[model samples]
Target: MDQRNALLGEQFGICPICLKPDPEHVDHDHETGKVRGVLCFSCNAALGQFRDRPDVMRRAAAYVEGNVWKPKLVAPGVYRLPS
Candidate 1:
C-alpha cells in the first residue's frame, strides 16, 4: 500500500476506472463537491485540463456533440477576431 493511500479510506482508495490501487491523488471540484473519480497519474492530469469548470467543459462537450469542431485542415486555420 502506498503511504498516500493511507490518507484516503481503505477500500475507497481503489480507482473505479482501471480498478488499480491508486495512490492518494483523489481529485475533487473546488466549486462543487462533485466526486470526479479515482484515477491514476495519467487520468488525473487529463482531468486537471478540465479545471473543474462544468459550464465551460459542457460547452466544449456541446461543440463536440454539435459538430462545431473541424478536423484535418491542410492550410492555416482562420479564426474570428474578437471585437
Candidate 2:
C-alpha cells in the first residue's frame, strides 16, 4: 500500500483532527516532506489557512477563548466587524 494508505489504515481511515471517516488528505510537513497523518478537507484547509503555523493557531485559539469581542451578522450577506 502507498504511504498515505498505510497512514490512513493506521488512523482507521479517519481524520486525526476531526475524527471524520474517509479522510483522503495526507497531512505532512511541507518543509521536510514528512508524513504527519490523514485529515479531512476542512481540517486540512484550516491548517493551510493558518500557514501551518502552530503559533498562529494557538493565538487564534486564545483569541476565541479570550472573547475580546463578538461579531454579529447584520444581514444575509453582511456582518459586523470586531472592534
Candidate 3:
C-alpha cells in the first residue's frame, strides 16, 4: 500500500536500530531528507541528539563497548587522543 505501511512490512513492525517492536517514528537522513527506516521513540531521539553524525555515533558505540580512548597531554593544556 502506502510508504509507511510498506516500511512497517519491510521491517516487520520492529525498530531496525534496536530491534524493538511497534516503532512509531520514521527515521530519515536530515541532509538528504530521505526515509531510512522506522524507529522507536528512544532510538529516534538518540539519533536526533547525535545530530546524525555517523562518526560520533561510532565513537559513542565504541565507548559503550568499553573501548574508551584516554586523552594524552601533548603540550601545555593540550590533550590529544591517539588515532
Each candidate structure's TM-score, on Cα atoms with residue i matched to residue i, is: 0.38, 0.71, 0.88
Residue pair clashes in candidate 2: none
Rank by TM-score (best first): 3, 2, 1
Give Cα distance to truth, residue 58, candidate 3, Å. 1.1
Q: 1-83 in candidate 3: lDDT tens per residue? A: 38987998999989999999989898999999999988999999999999999888999999999999898998999999657
State the weakest 10-residue window (summed lDDT) of model 1. 1-10
Off by over 4 Å in 1: 1-13, 33-37, 53-68, 71-83
lDDT of 2 by residue, 1-83 (tens): 49888999899888988899999888888889887998999999999899899977876887889855466889997988754
Q: For model 1, how does the per-residue alpha-carbon lDDT over 1-83 read when each residue is reduced to its tens digit?
A: 35345544544767654567754466667678675554677657656787866666666777878845445545689554321
- The better candidate by TM-score, 2 or 3, is 3
- Candidate lDDT scores, in order, read 0.60, 0.85, 0.92
RMSD (CA, Å), candidate 1 to true, equals 7.7
Ranking by lDDT: 3, 2, 1
Which candidate number has the best lDDT?
3
lDDT of 1: 0.60
